[model samples]
Target: MTHTYKINGMTCDGCRTKVENALNTIEGVQATVTLNPMEATITMEKHVPTEELQDALSAAGNYTIQMTLPPSHDGHHHQPH
Candidate 1:
């Protein structure tokens, strides 16, 4: 399945590369990490646990990732109000 996660604390191309590298190193992760919007889109061969992803981010030392919100759908936006 394809997973899109909103990542925080990534501020540069270097950080972006770092995130990509970490996730790509995982056995099942085929990931593309972009810093412009601070997100990682990952395609996995199997279900990789979310904690494993968080562990990768934490190991990077400079990246702190958290789920913000999923993309808008059905022409409607979701806001926490």
Candidate 2:
């Protein structure tokens, strides 16, 4: 399933990459993040707990979720983070 999350504190491409990389590091996630829109789209291969994803983003020290993207909209690619 693919999940989208509205995130905060991603100011630059580097910040975006960090969050993206962290999310990608998870066992089941394939993450893509946009800095302009401040969001991360995560594709999972298995059942990944939402709390786990949130914690990893939190550990990056600059991300907060505004809203979570539902699975039904995986193809709705938006603008920058």
Candidate 3:
């Protein structure tokens, strides 16, 4: 499913690219980030929790990501850490 998230701490295109790359690191995830509104639209093959996404973003930069909307479906949830 595709999910939208609000991203914070991006200051420029470079920062946007970094966040995008970081999010892409996770398995089965593809992310696109836009700086104007500081948001990301992510496509996932499986359920991935926000914390895992945060870990990837933290490693790349000081960015933070949170869901813009509650998940569409809670089914097939991946185990959380």
Off by over 4 Å in 1: 67-81
Best by lDDT: 3
RMSD of each: 2.9, 7.7, 7.5
Per-residue alpha-carbon lDDT of candidate 2 for residues 1-81, written as tens digits (9 for 90 to 100): 877878788888888888888888889789899987778888898878777887898888767754463556577667798
Model 1 per-residue lDDT tens digits across residues 1-81: 898888888878888999899989889799899877889999999998878988998898667666556667786876899
Ranking, TM-score, top scorer first: 3, 1, 2
TM-score of each: 0.79, 0.73, 0.83
- Give each model's clash number: 0, 8, 0
Candidate 2: residue 68 lDDT (0-100)? 66
For model 3, which pairs clash? Answer: none
